[model samples]
Target chain A: MKPDSPFLDLETAPRVAVSIDGAPLELPEGANLAAALLAAGVTVFRHTPVSGAPRGPFCMMGACFDCLVDIDGFTRQACMIEVSQGLRIIRPRDLGADDVDA
Target chain B: MSTHDLIVIGAGPAGMATASKAADLGLTVAVLDEQPRAGGQVYRDVDRVAALRGDILGADYTQGATLTAGLHHQAIEHVPGATVWAIEDGFRVSYTRAGRGAQIAADRILLATGALERPMPLPGWTLPGVMTAGAGQILLKQSGVLAKSAALVGCGPLLYLIAAQMVRAGTPPVAMIETQTRSDLIEAARHVGGALRGWPYMLKGLKMLAEITRAKVPRYPGATEIRIEGTDTAEAVSFVHRGRAHRIACRTVFLHHGVVPNTQAARSLGVSHRWHAGQSCFAPRLDVWGQSDVTGVFIAGDGAGIGGAKAAELAGRLAALKVAEESGRLSTDERDRQAAPLRSAHARELAARPFLDRAYPPFAGALAPEDATVICRCEEVTAGDIRGHARLGCLGPNQAKAFSRAGMGPCQGRYCGLTVTSLLAAANGTSHDETGYYRIRPPLKPVTLGELATLEHSAPDTAE
Candidate 1:
């Protein structure tokens, strides 16, 4: 992570190991997944299927779907997820990330 | 199915207060919310955040702890981390938790779904580095994450509060690009008398501005032609201020132009909605008691209209009292006596809204952006496309949505519904009311098929 990234790490909680886009990183436990990713210098959360454009956590609430990511093969809002051990997150794209959903 | 005397759809100030108030009135209450805690967005994760960084979030946010404390009432079931997806006739509620679905029944339903930031669609707003100011507040509250030196753009008191919050966190914003102009000020002055009745709120805003001033953050008022400029990500914010064009180099940009009622859950209920021209959005047509056209269904808080947090709490109390009386738990006279003070307090809390509405109306072009600006983030539909659909004989937002798939994303038009309505309104030369919003359907949140399969279907509640 950049020492002076635009986000400050105010979390003093113990860190846990989580994989992002297949890379391992230590993030504060129980932190919001989206905020943790951003603080860890992972801004681009997913690529839009329509235009293939990079998108991040815009609303940080569930209203904006820009923070969608694949956690254990299910597309979910990173902002809605809490950081935990062994959360495998990947930014799925192109073929429509949520096609598996009803 | 779990049954209740009343089911509250959100755990915001309104929902939380309603649950406790109704429980006090001897009505069994259930408060379901998507957050992990009781403090909706305004006070999300209030207990822990209060201990971790209460000083950074300020007293206004930490005060939510008191509201959350009431969730512990035995008569009130605080079902946190549950996203409500369906509200059927006869008070049948459907929701998802941990990718599993469940159904519950209630005699009464109160939607306190609250507000969402109005989408500030401009060139390159879809870039990875741009976010709403509300998102910044959420990060700080939920996870103690603070944006560092980001430019706070657009308008409203929220921008000031966020700038102040960041200042206190020791990572003051790089600048504030305000969109309110002289005309907005003149328009706001007409309502200043009533706004002064809300002096405490106005004072809070002033203090926030003072904090920003103390931090020496650069302020650009009356900014026009605002745009986020970059290729892969937001690199800088460019705008015209005082007739001189300037570009500020910044890696991140936080945008705001006030908030609108998050009407998705309300609209899904098929309730009547009216266009609010001042706020430039649609609000559910609700009675003074916060009851919607659908009998026994109520909407309080920002979901009914954008009346901030305190007003929502009052609305919740008033609505709960009405429900309690109608349920035969309280006498009509007693209900009125209980609601009288709440009604007055609600009025006082909302006194400044008209001024705030005019002073920081949805920024021009937000409703009708340039042809290239993407209005629908999910479908990547642009304003020009919606207008093109209008030219292609699309009559309203629904038709435009059907023609261009503008509101088909997982968000279900939460972000772009108003913009599509406005673009079509202008294109068809009709009133915004005529150019209605998308017809929001069931499963308000994206529910997987496997999740829906978990729902144990039950007949709608027959108890009136």
Candidate 2:
């Protein structure tokens, strides 16, 4: 994977450990989950259910729900969620299969 | 429910201004915002981000510091991270803060929810690396990060603004693919005289353009037929420029047409809205003082229309002044005297808007993307799916949504509402206004049933 993110230096900000798909990674604490994941060279946040197309954060604000991922059993927008220690994040294989009734 | 003189939803420039001004006029005000901090999207985390990277983010962002500071007035109560789920009749607001549900009643309600980037659906727009230009700017503002090399696509002031900011942060884009044609520039020239009244804004845009040009960034103007080519993520962008086909290799592609008023909250409250052909979106109808047709309900800022921040601040203050006067807190004479100067300033600030709107109208092709292009990111609905549903007797956006599930995802229609409406209009052979938009219902945002069940007044009322 290419290093797309410019903020790779973790010394300027506080660092915390997080798991993406069960793989441990260190990200800046208080940074948005999408940014942290992108910085770690993790794109393709989730795959769509309809066509199995890959998607990532589009709006960055909460408006675009393309960055939805499983956080602790409940799906949440990665752009809206913040990074914290020992946070377990899972990228869904298929969004349609993981649909939970609201 | 605890009742107050006023309840302001959103803590952006408009909401902050309204709350502070209303509090100053002796009205008890409570401000609720979803973000952990005030300043909305434009001024997100201003206090901290400005202090850390003031030079990088620029003065336009640091200016938000003043509004965020004003929100700290002693007379005003601010609630951060509160998601307002519903607004009932009699100005009752239901919200959840930190997973706990609560309700508040107010004599007046002001919605300053702000604007959203216009949806620009295109080929491969759903790919991982394709995101909005505003999203790139938000990353820079909130986390001081940028992509190593990317192609900045689309048009409008925000495209240039983000490109220049990226250059300042030492991560200039590999290329800029601007979609505005020579004719658009000629169209904009007619309004130069009126736009000159807002010279500072014009100069700011010029400075950004100059900066990008000086950096020697490759810019392709009048580009068309843009297609992002990548299977899993955006690897390259191909477009036609100067009657020639060109492809730029890059990992990221930022798309932005312009911004539209975020009208979901207001619409859900049953406030009447009309299609704003100038900006090409639906805006809630409001009086000069920002009051809606619903009594005691007011709307301010870009949520009403794309008036920018300065205009939003003035409009916010004017709405608060009207609220104060209507509640008997201020004399009509005092209200008039205070609002006169702000009105003039607001007009001056908005003078260039007509030119900007005409110069960079929502990219026409973006509204009606190709058949295979995804229009709704949440449901993965394609433009073909929507048009197919329209042919099956879908009358408007709401009907199309029910048939295709384009606007039924967690986003609820924020991203796809405008595009769906336009697609329906085209398919039905009607104007966007006649095609209409989604019929919004609460909880406006996705709220858990557990959260609603925990409301302070969840028990049924036998008295009723």
> By lDDT, who's the top model here?
1
Q: What's the DockQ of model 2?
A: 0.57
Clashing pairs in 2: none
lDDT, candidate 2, B37-142, per-residue tens: 8888889889888888788779999999999988888878899988898998877898988778888888899999999989889888888988899899888888
Looking at candidate 1, what is the lDDT of residue B261?
A: 92
Q: What is the TM-score of candidate 2?
A: 0.96
lDDT of 2 by residue, A1-102 (tens): 335453332225788887888887888888888887887788888887777778888888888778889888777888877788889999988656656633
DockQ of 1: 0.81
lDDT per residue, candidate 1, B299-321, as tens digits? Answer: 99999889899999999999999
User: After TM-score superposition, what is the CA distance of residue B16 in candidate 2 from its true location, in Å?
Assistant: 0.9
What stretches of model 2 exceed 4 Å from their correct place?
A: A1-11, A95-102, B458-464
For residue B292, model 1's alpha carbon misses the true position, in angstroms, by 0.8
